[model samples]
Target: MIFVVTPKIPHFLHFTYGSRPSFSSIHSKNSATSLASTLKSISSSPSLISHGQQLHCFILKSGLNFDVFIQNSLINMYSKTGMFSCARSIFESSPTLDCASFNIIISGYLKNGRLGDAYKLFEKMPLRDCISYTTMIIGFAQNECYEDALALFREMRLLGVVPNEVTMQSVLPAYARADGTRINAMLLHGLVAKLGLDMNVVAWNVMLNGYVKGGLVDLARDLFDEIPGKSTYSWSTMIGGYLQVGRLVEALALYCEMRRTDSRPNEVMLIHIVSTCAQATRLLEGRQCHALALKMGMNFHDFMQATLIHLYAACQQVELAYLLFQEGTKDDIPCWNALIAGLMRNGIVNEAARLFSIMPQRNVLSWSSMISGYAQNGKHRLAIEVFHEMVGKGFKPDETTMVSVFSAISGLCALKEGRWAHQFIRCNSIPINDKLSTAIIGMYAKCGSIDSALEVFDQIRDKARIVNPWNAIIYGLAMHGKAEASLRIFADLQSRKIKPDSITLYGILSACCHAGLVEEGKSHFRSMTAEYGLEPNHKHYRCMVDLLGRAGRLNEAEELVQNMPMEADAVTWSTLLAACKMYENIDVGERAARNLARVEPSYGPGRIALSNLYADAGRWNDAFLVRRAMHNENLARSLDCGVSRLCNALDLT
Candidate 1:
């Protein structure tokens, strides 16, 4: 006989036992017994709450409301339906209560997250059982009060309450969360084996998960392999462990092994595989995983879709990424950001901008991606434009955004914009970290504000001033001809025990070149390999050549070029050629010109330098020959403006 509750009258009781039992027919002991039996049956099913309610009304009408069994059943029903207030009312109004009564109400409170109330009522209980302790232990773990949960489990043990598999499941996660609790978890594992609970699949999965979250991937893998029959969750947990420690290859191998087994990968496992593919940049494997996802009918999951988008983008497969984005729901901001960032990465700035314009909504990530994309592509003006648009639309830029905007300003040499960015950083009280400080220093230096650059450098705390910012400051001072100050800063950097990198030595060499400190330049250049153990690259060699050649020591410069450990690239030879042009040394100039032309015949700057060298030395025929060669090679048009300026300066025309 089916029993149902009518929603038209919430308080009224109706029964469909064989035939509908009317209110008039429900006034007997047998009828009341039947009604109470139906309520007990329906109470466990939360969907039958209305029917349970109607049964409760009938129980009251039959004078069974004061019955302990019926009232506890009602409490259980209300708690299961998430109607905690009604459950509490029944518990408080009960005249006769048992340990079952306390356990029911306490479990309700625990399930409802009323931990304080659960603890209070637990304290007031006259009798406690293993179920009582287990409920509270699980409650504490569920609420993330790991310490309290462990403390209570110890207390339960002290009271001689033997823990079952459920108890181990609850307490194991607590151990995972607390620090220095791995030993306790291991001890619990031993206890579980001793208690013959190790065969319980749920208990084993919990132990494996505990080890994973505790960052013990090796132990987790060991435990995982020991499991006689692993579940999908077991595979997922171990895979996540490997990913956490950057063991992407192992993660993928395990995932592939899982696929070989009968265990079907769920949405979570697919997401992890996709993420592993992204991190490893394995496009082929990622595509196979995508195909598997489609085959398994798990592509509808929003998170999995987002992860796949990121995976394709990371592989530099922008078209595939955009196709995925269009195929999925576009409302997810992360998916949008991933596509935009991917487009920017492939240098498709216009497409990225177009996508950014039509996004349904914009977040900090959206704006930051566009700004960074524009800046990275050398569209500094567009980058600044997006920054302003972001601000005018009331989006507060984050530290990353500020850094990109400052970089754009530095590129454009827009002092006004640079000053505004600095002010914005100051007004917002943004913490000046190394990256931002370096950007600020570079911006001020490029904008011809050496004092502001120095001020920014001075404001950096000693501990926060790393090598990069020091390089910026030294390079800035040297570029503006503050050679002595630049060298002083380098000395300060050394005294502070900050090690100089290749770029730092390059800045010092540049300072020496500008100040004509040929001896200092030579000492620092030799020290690059001697004291610092830095193998000087071509840039370092070029700087040295420039320093010596500028001082009219063209012979020494030529010798340095010939004996360089690395091949002197075109730039190094071009530096010597320019120095020759400056001092009108035809011998070294011709040699430099020959090497430059050989290294890069298509490079216009090298040809122009050679032309200028001939013009300066009154070798008109030789100069014309170089010019005609440039014209014959179709290089003159590209360099016409610079060559025109050089001819006008030297009255060659």
Candidate 2:
């Protein structure tokens, strides 16, 4: 029942022996030849595993079971089809196996993402040959098991296996992914020189990428210069290395040099340079490349077209990007995703949504792009809606998708939606690390759920995650009338040698002012200037003024404001004026109002505070005069509702 497809040959065949010399004999020869040809074709076509199996049956029936070529091909075909059980059976049953057979099986397993199967076959291979070892090493490296790959390479050396060009090519990439230290990379460089494997392009590329990725761009260029008989890959590697590290000018220069050398730019070179131009936001440079691509007649390739979309989007040329997208002949899903993302980048949310809705095929990237676009445009509701639709379509979101969704929920302050995302993440066993966990805490804090924020903060064992989570907890506690607790946390941060940033100091100072801890507030203000060497900014000065004002020490607060090195703006003077009104200190209130009017001539709060002081002092005519001035200036103060809540809760006694 086994059948293999091969090229049709006319009137060719083989026979058992000289049985007869008739038409049947001629036809039989042709049939046998066709069958053999078919077997050869099936062996190479990775998609014909089922047909290759049928050919295997024919080989068995025709007594060609001992044919080494036939057996090796069967093993390779089965591995390609992910029929590892069948490949194993053929491999074990075959009395003889060569390095080629082992390599084929290992490569196939690696391609199929079956690392365990690759390792098992590698273990069973005889001779511990270099090809076999290199194949498995590459498998481990590609699978991102970098540490294991390095361990295996070391074991290869312990077995007295001399490292060859193939060995260096396969194992050097593992070092790059591991972010191996400069010393470690230098050690590998020495090994390459000692082994005389400099001509190994893969090893050299890996090392170059390592240095570029590690911000050792100078070192990478030095190595590139030393490379003898540079190939197109060498030039492309340098271009990409420079591009990766944001050296757009260097990458472009290298690309020009590559062209001058008559090296034909490939898809990789085009994508790398175009991406760099996009990042640089150089619209003019990108247009030249677009013209060059058209001249080179590579405008139709999917990768090149995708880069064009990205380039136009990044340059903020939405109209031009749209025109290019409309003219695109190819309708690949990636092309559509790129265009939609471009539209989103330009703040054309409606256009992006339209394109997203009509996309013929939507993958995770496409779905995530739409969701992120909605979130970026402050349309979180639509973002959540699209995410739900994506999930309904059975598209499982990855970590990137989760991060976007987390951001959307936080932006909308939709804790209920955030809970759903959390549930999905938990059910899927996604690790709640700093990025996602911090977003969750931030969402709760924004929604006025300090208790929830604290609960999440407590669960985090690493204080070095970010200063943000600490800022959230401290500010939330201070706002919720827990100044003592907030101050304790701030002290703890100092005790642990965690240098508090401006936000940290501001939050703690505000808490002290609200709690009427004048001494504690003064202590912090002095420490901030004298101990931490942090120059008191306007915010810090304002907090200090508020501290004295709330403690009914109006004279001291007025003196602080008067002596501020920088000009006291409306906010600083307004705080002092509000404090004066609260304590009914008319003299200081008038002085603060005069200072405020000079800084903020059109400020409604300044006029209003002055009017309030006049009304309290029974100066009806003066109050009316300030009101007329406010009316003439057309300065209106829309009371900030959030700040109103804070002020209402404050006990200014």
Candidate 3:
């Protein structure tokens, strides 16, 4: 039998209310019914608190104040109006109460962010139900107290209280938020299926969110297909999952399928899709999302507007990006940051600065964008200047800002500044995670401190698990002509069972080139496709050509170029031609020069190298012809390709 305590409000009110206004006549049934209706309506609108107060006065006079229902309504009214002191006073004074009386005050505490109070009241509750458990669970989950929420769920299960749809919805997200709880999610799924909530779309969506967040995209897709009635949220969860894991092809395919369905997408989902498109530089899909947003009349808020500006800039449509920024709410900082970041991405550094200087308000992100943008555009000195300015203005630099600052210091090869940044990172106690560790290593390596790079690499706990630190050390060794040391590091990486990525391959190949390791280079080139399933790109092939040419393997180098699936570009031909010139191989050098000219008619380096090769070989006539062609190429093209390319984020230390 459910417990129900008898109320002592009549005795409590004797002292609590003190006195009541004299009623001219007895309260009729119509008056009591009207009062009940008014309280219910007033509960939803906090603005009618004064009107509710007037009703409270009427209650004390009508002798209906003893009613538990009337007291609950009054407590609810005060809670909704953010008058928690009054709500708690009524709750404590009432001796007689039911389950709802506890639930109401508990919900009031929860809505007001008083979890501790809510839990205390719940423990004191004379009776509890599914609502009580679910409310507490949701409250804990909202505050990121996932363990507490899940514990309460277990307690509810142990008490034999059946979970409703609301309970499942709250519990699924709680488990998802907690790390190492994916297994618990499966158990919850079994519970949900047993309870016959399998067809519930909200439950399915929450479960799908769990799978996505757990990095199990394939499992999420499998479950997503099983969902009977897919909602807009379902599609967004799956699409976002794919994007988060960098599965752009899969994300785009799913997006196409979503478009074919009848469900209209929500603004947040569309906004995220647009944002991902910007990061991947997928211009076509980004434009499509923009058009759809316009057609669907999604709210043009600062964030979405900023994302659009970033998208346009990423696509190299600078004018469109500028126009959109001009038309947006200029006062909003996000739109301004987007415009500035876009300019940086497209190598419009000066324009980004101009806009950054004039923005009405500046946040930490605004300062970060400027520092990163300047570094990206090869203005390392300017990047450092902006970083100091940001700190002078009292904006504490976050990890991301420090990453950009270290990058600029690396660019300038300023050992002093790099050391200062390192000291600052330690003083601030920033966690040296994989990305920051990699950046710090790269900075030290490029600043002519290979020993420091190795020290940083050794200090990282995830050095073997992550490829970046290994890459930095190997590249640093190769840069310093410690080719044997670089090779040994690669061997150590293999022994650790660490899978090497493209950057790792580049570092090893460069190491081989520096050490003149013909056999080692050939073995790696073959293993790239044979063992690692990695196809060697143009750069890899260029390194091989330089190695083989330097080692007098001219025929093999020529054959590799000829058999490469992709056409040999200017860099490849230049490498081959340089090798040919070293060995005085006129036949191969001529072939390389002709191909280089065909591919890049305005590349002066290829033509100049060919002329030098001829002049060194005493082929005066051929050298004169090459010089004339270079002169004509220069006259035909006013801008050098090299200069144009370097202006757009191509600087290296």
Candidate 4:
């Protein structure tokens, strides 16, 4: 707001006044005392801007305002109080500025997430050092401007500045965040190697994590082996890596090695191992780890407790899962869901329902767990009841519950119940997508209604959803004595570019044997191996034997059994024995029965088929001995006796 004055007249007036009356030295002491008092008062009430303005006027009157300590104190007070404009004024007015002063303002701006202002001040600073650059880069990365962070790092390097380990550690994860086949990750690792930053344990862990998250497990392992010494994080990364790829046994071994090496497994490592144990279903190992975690005093952590609940449930130790659930202090929704799911998994649906009802809070997962438990337990009515409650409570069902409930109703063969559920789904406009339709088809098939099942099957055209439905429909048709219809379904599945699984082939092959279509069955079996790349397991081989045996080709069936790469299980040998019964080949039947007995002496189906073969051959003594052996083994013969039928009579009123 000042204007320029004529220099000659101003200089003449200033010289005359300055020479005539110099102020007494006594005034200097008063000025000094006043400025000191003012600085002290401002410092005490520094937060008040109005007081600061009055103090500014007093300092201008005292003419002792340039005290560096006072200026710095004012800057600190304003910056601390978030009065950046006032803080910047004090900073700009200072004639003597040091790195410390610059750092204070820069840190203030950075802390407030005002990176633009921070960068501007950083550029204007006369001194650029490691701490300055580190602060800026950290702010950039923290703000998620990773590219800018890297660019600043490059700028630091070009200035012939050597970055310290902290510098490398801050920016390394930025490369991980940028995606290009993980090239940035690899480049960063190479930079670390070239810079010899391995002595920095933090840097090494970051690189190890980069490799892990980038899916370079081999590279991660290589880096792991080369580490001068590994820490808990290093062990966790490797263990987690093995786990991510389902190499559960390897993960276990590493955990053991880690324990042997005396690396104190912290809470995180324990959680990872617990999850791995759950996946591996190693209940005993999980218990051991649980004990270790308790000894280590990490038992109170909510994450560990949740994992313990899941592990116990997966091991089918629902009692232990409940015990943990009871002891847990933090009962999150997931914790409740895990306990409920565990109970359901162990077929303790009644207990699951009890727990679910008492849950303080219920989300979709809790409801789904209860529904799934009832459905799997063949309590289809209860499952549907839960679904209705879910809808009535305004909790919309998810896909998992839909699929699970549909499957349960189908398994129970409750045709009326299934139809009612179907109608409800339709009225509510629930998607009758591939999964729902497949479940319906499975339901009809279970009820021995092939035509209705096939009608539902015809509607699914999506290849992804078609294959599974086709497999279900085929199995249903084959079990109902309509083998030809099963084979035809399989053919249609194959024609639509939807590859069938061994299960589909298993059904079709059995159907082919039942219908005496040996050639077609053989062709389909071959296609399973050649086209689908499916290894013919014992089930497939058993179906092949049935296919051959039904055609009166006993020798081919025997050859198929003998040529099995693995030992034929009870089902495989039993299928061959059944063929012997149908073809009346007593000698082969006896051999199959003996093999079957060796495989599983107590299986009722095998024992009955063998005993009947001896009876049909008039080997009454052998048949009596077989029955005696069965009785001695305490294997009861399943009563395939006639089941009484109920006749429904309609009365016209």
Query: Top model by TM-score, which number?
Result: 3
- Give model 4's clash tally: 0
Worst window of 10 by summed lDDT in candidate 3 = 644-653
Question: Per-residue lDDT for 57-170 in model 1, tens only?
Answer: 877876777777767767776776788899899889888887877887888887777899998998898887777888888878877777888998899889888888888887
Model 4, position 513, has a per-residue lDDT of: 70
Off by over 4 Å in 1: 1-315, 530-533, 564-566, 631-653
What Cα-based lDDT does every candidate model obtain?
A: 0.81, 0.74, 0.79, 0.73
- Candidate 4 clashing pairs? none
> What is residue 113's positional error in candidate 2, in angstroms?
20
For candidate 3, what is the lDDT? 0.79
Best candidate, lDDT = 1
Q: Which ten residues in a row have the lowest lDDT in candidate 4?
A: 643-652
User: Model 3: per-residue lDDT, tens digit, 292-402?
Assistant: 878776637777888899898888988988888888787889989988998898888888899888888999999999999999989999999999999899888888988
lDDT comparison, 2 vs 4, better candidate: 2
What is the TM-score of each predicted model, taking all chains together? Answer: 0.55, 0.54, 0.64, 0.54
Q: What is candidate 1's TM-score against the reference? A: 0.55
Better of 1 and 3 by lDDT: 1
Per-residue lDDT over 565-646 for candidate 4, one digit per residue giving the tens place of the 0 to 100 score: 9998878888888888787798778677666655664467775786687788887876776677556555667632110110
